[model samples]
Target: MEEYIVSLNDLKKSYGSKSVLDGVSLHVKKGEIIGYIGPNGAGKSTTIKIMLGIESNYQGEVKLFGQDIAEDSIEYKRKIGYVPEIADLYDNLTGFEYLTFIGELYGLTPQLADYKAKNLMELFGIGEVYHSRIASYSKGMRQKLLIISSLLHNPELLFFDEPINGLDANSVMIFKEIMTQLAAQGKTIFYSSHIMDVVEKISSRIILLNNGKIAADGTIEELKQINQEGSSLEQIFNELTGFNEHQAIGAKFVSIVEEM
Candidate 1:
């Protein structure tokens, strides 16, 4: 039997009478790269927040490594790494200082933290900026630092939300390779992104959510097979998410522009 690393059972969340996640259930096994894609406001961020223990007021059970998250929040959190959509950092601190601070929080020795920070920053081609304040870094540079921090402890599970947001083409390619290698090493990755091509190519399985519910869950080939004969992943996604009016909307926009 395959061991599940993460499990969500009938998860639900609401904000002031508005439901964000409605009876969402899913299981992620060890070594699986789950591409979690959804339309904006489809509860993707909400679900991730609950899983990461950022929001605790939701109803339902979330288990990690066969342990209930609520039962041992610290232990559960220690085993996972998360990169949120927004890269929130202390802009006043230098890259090296920030990473070292994160390492201290993870209980790493100062020497070890410094070594890892330097090595990872060097690997990402940003070692020259290690001593520069974060406020001086570009979007891509800050993103690289964030990635380094997330991997500092080598957690068993990684949750990445729009990780490639400000990355250049080369950095994006490197990130994809890193993800693939991590999965090969039996690390579970729960990736959320708007880049359909990358998700379709990399994900072993895809989960599409709409209106706080899972609309499709399968491999890319399976999803395409379920749709039209030659449907692409984007097509399958559009069909599942009910976003079929793009062509019409585009035409209308063009007509309005011409009238103007």
Candidate 2:
């Protein structure tokens, strides 16, 4: 049998009368870079939250490293790293302080955490600002800091939700290469993003969630084969989501702007 690093079976989550995740089942094998995409409010974040063990109260099983999370969520978390879509950083803390804190939380010694934080910042070209407060950092800088923090302890399973949100082109290129290299080293990456182009380039497989369920899941080549031939990932996304109003919407918006 093939080994799976992450598995979800009949997963379901609801808030009050409305359902968010209506049975999501998936098996993520080791070293696969799975790009997760969906329209707004498609329960993408909820699915990731469940896998990270940050959200419970759902029905079904979520297994990471061949063990059900419900059985022991805390212990297994040491092997995982997550960069959420939205997170609040400690504005008063310096970059060095914050990253070391995260590393320590993941079970690294204080001395090792500090040493690694310094080297990573230097490699990322942010070593000059290591002592600067997070509040003083630009959007891209802060985003980079978060990414660094996630990898400080070198977790095997990574969940990065919109991790490249404010990254510059150069940073984005480096990150893509880093992701590929990590996968080559047997790291399992579940990356969620709305940027179709980047997703197309980096993902070994793509999973589209729509209406509280997985709409499509396959390699980019497989997705292309099933949908319109010679279509781009963005085009395929629109077709799969039944979205054809872009031209109309753009014209209407431009007309409204010119009305004044």
Candidate 3:
């Protein structure tokens, strides 16, 4: 019997008059690479926040490793790794220092943290800037540092939001390889991204969220069956989410200005 690493039931959140999540439920099993896809304001981040115990004021239950997260938030958090969209880091700290700080917070020894940080920085091709202040790093470099920090603790469950956002082709390929390797090692990963191609190529299962609700959840073929579009994940996404790229307000505005 496979263990469920993450389980949510009727998870919901609201801010003032606006409800961000509405009865969202999901379950992730051990060694599963679940790709969570949704457009802007579709409540994807909210769900992740709740799961990570970053936002506790929500309705419903969250469980990790078969233990209730609400009862033991810190314990559950220690077992999970998170890399958010905005890779915020301490400007004054060097890349190595920042990673060391996070590892210590997770109870890793200073020497061990430094060792892991060095290897990860090298693997991500950011070792040259390991001693540089985070403020001096580029967007891609900062993103890589953040990923290294997340993995320093060797977490059993990982949450990645746009993990390859600023990465180049080679780095992106490396990340995909790492994700596959992690899954093969019996670790569960929750990947959230707007990149349909990456998700299609890597995810063992995909969950599509639309209007704060689950529109589809299954493998690529199953999703195609649901919408009857066998083209690709991109086509299935557009058809199911009803998000059109061609119809843009900026494009229409520019056209009107040109005509005038």
Clashes of each: 0, 0, 0
lDDT score, candidate 3, position 95 = 86
Alpha carbon deviation, residue 232, candidate 3 (Å): 1.5
Candidate 2 lDDT by residue in tens digits, 9-123: 9999999999999999999999999999999999999998888888989999999999999998788889888898888999999998999899889889999999999988888
True-structure Cα RMSD, model 2: 1.0
Taking all chains together, the TM-score of candidate 1 against the true structure is 0.96
Model 2: runs farther than 4 Å from truth? none
The parts of candidate 3 lying over 4 Å away from their true place are: 245-260
| Candidate 2 to truth, TM | 0.98
- Alpha-carbon RMSD to native, per candidate: 1.3, 1.0, 1.9
Clash list (residue pairs), candidate 3: none
Instruction: Provide the global lDDT of candidate 1 against the true structure.
Output: 0.90
lDDT of 1 by residue, 205-232 (tens): 9999999999989998888887874377
Better of 1 and 2 by lDDT: 2
Candidate 1: worst 10 consecutive residues by lDDT? 224-233
User: Which scores higher on lDDT, 1 or 3?
Assistant: 1
